[model samples]
Target: MEIVIINSSPRKNGNTAQLCDAFIKGAMQTLPKPKVTTVFLNDLKFKGCQSCFACKLKDSKRYGKCSLNDELSPILSAVNKADCLVLASPIYLMDVNSSAKAFLERLCFSLGSYEVGYRSLAPKEVIVVTIYTMNTTIEYSPVGAMDNVDAFLGHIFSTPRRLCAYNTYQFQDYSKYVVDVFDETEKLKYRDKEFPKDLLRAYDLGRDIATRL
Candidate 1:
């Protein structure tokens, strides 16, 4: 199986990246020598869709490709070849970061239009998994955090399987900072106890997705 993971977290070893790493660990177990690729969105120099309509223009051969000759082109090419696409991102103010959102726009919008409805030029059978890490618990997350997005992406690929790690560790050393609101002890509890469960689930989910493919 070919899997491509786009990690949008700037923190290279943060919770979101850890989950992606765990997922890849289990996925490789399912398929020997799986072709897995991970792209950190922060490392790329790219921009949101410019609304150039090059993709939509008549006689344009780049219908399914973005014309911007930048860092995202190769990533999109990888997606074109991938059997499974995994998006790992830390929640920023209840949504994906700017890079993820921009990549998504180019990935989906350039290939198709909203009036024509959302679509992807990627394979029809490509599986999708999205992992979200946030500081708030699932119970407290805004209603729109993951809602509608599943279905929207489902329109482009398949109905995406999702993973969430809530109440995450936000700092390397809580004592170093003077943020008074969060109880460091309780944060440690969620970090040491709860977050591991999310990693385990992520591992299992990788295997599950791979097996399904």
Candidate 2:
């Protein structure tokens, strides 16, 4: 299966990446040797959607292509070819981080346009998901609203799957940072006792997607 993981966490080994790693491990264990491709959005050089009408130009073959010729071009191509695609990112403010949001915008413009009416460009049977990791607890109102972002993703990538991690680790060394909103002690306790379970769930989802492939 051609599984593509777009990781938007700027931290290389942050909580989001850990969850993604578990998913990849599970997918890798599947038959025929799963070819897992991971793209770290922070490592790429690209801008957000430019709102240009080039893709909408009449008789233009570039209707489904981002005009920018940068690092994200190939990644978008991978999304088009993917049998299963995962959009994983850390929640910033009330939604996905900037990099992730930008990627989605470009994808939206590339895959479909209002001029042509909205349409999906992904494989009909593609298994797609959006995984979110947040410092706030799952019950947090905005965090709960995170699933709303999937309205578009689900429309583009088929009915999607999701893996959410709440009360995620925020700092590698909490002592070095001036932060007092959350009790680090309780967060660590939760991570030690609960995060593994979330990872396990992620593993299961990965295995399931691979199995479908």
Candidate 3:
């Protein structure tokens, strides 16, 4: 089976990427060893769709494809060929990171046609992975971000699922807005203590999709 994993976090080895790695490790342990391709959005060059409607033109070679060509074409092509898509992002400002949003917008434009609904050109299973520092008990925490992902995935996939991680707010003092200063030891402690549980959940989700595929 083919699976495309999109990592949208700007920080290379941050908490979100670490969790994704764990989940991927678990998936690799399964039999048949699914073919997995991971694309890091921060490393790519791409822009959002401008709604030029150029993709709708008939007799155009670029029909159903974004006109503003960049690094997205190859990635989108791989996504179309994959059996499952994994969207992983670190929550920024209570939502997905800017790179992830731009990728999604351009992808939506490329995969959608004017005559039909916003269905993926190639039907596929979808799974979303979101990591955030907000407490889960709060109303507008990491879990709330799922709504945005759901709206996007529901439009693109016939079957969509999700896995989320919250409560990374290990910092004792939230009085200041300085995110620059973080305690690495504390972060590692938190990861060692809490991240494994979430990673296991994501692994199970991946296995479930693999079984169906």
Off by over 4 Å in 3: 116-120, 123-138, 142-145, 169-192
lDDT per residue (tens digit) for residues 65-98 in model 2: 7787789989988888889889999999888999
Residue pairs with clashing backbones, model 2: none
Error of 3 at 212 (Å): 2.1
Clashes of each: 0, 0, 0
Descending-TM-score candidate ranking: 1, 2, 3
Q: What is the TM-score of each predicted model, taking all chains together?
A: 0.94, 0.93, 0.79
Measured on C-alpha atoms, candidate 1 has an lDDT of 0.84
Q: lDDT (0-100) at residue 3 of candidate 3?
A: 78
CA lDDT, candidate 2, residue 153: 75
Off by over 4 Å in 2: 115-117, 123-125, 141-145
lDDT of 3 by residue, 1-213 (tens): 777888897766765676667667766767358888988898998887788877778898878777787898788888767777777877777788788888878777666656655446544454443334333334557555667666666666643566667656444454455655655566556667877787777777666666666
Which number leads on lDDT? 1
Judge candidate 1 at residue 46 and give its lDDT: 92
Evaluated against the true structure, the overall lDDT of model 2 is 0.82
RMSD of each: 1.6, 1.8, 4.1
Per TM-score, the best of the predicted structures is 1
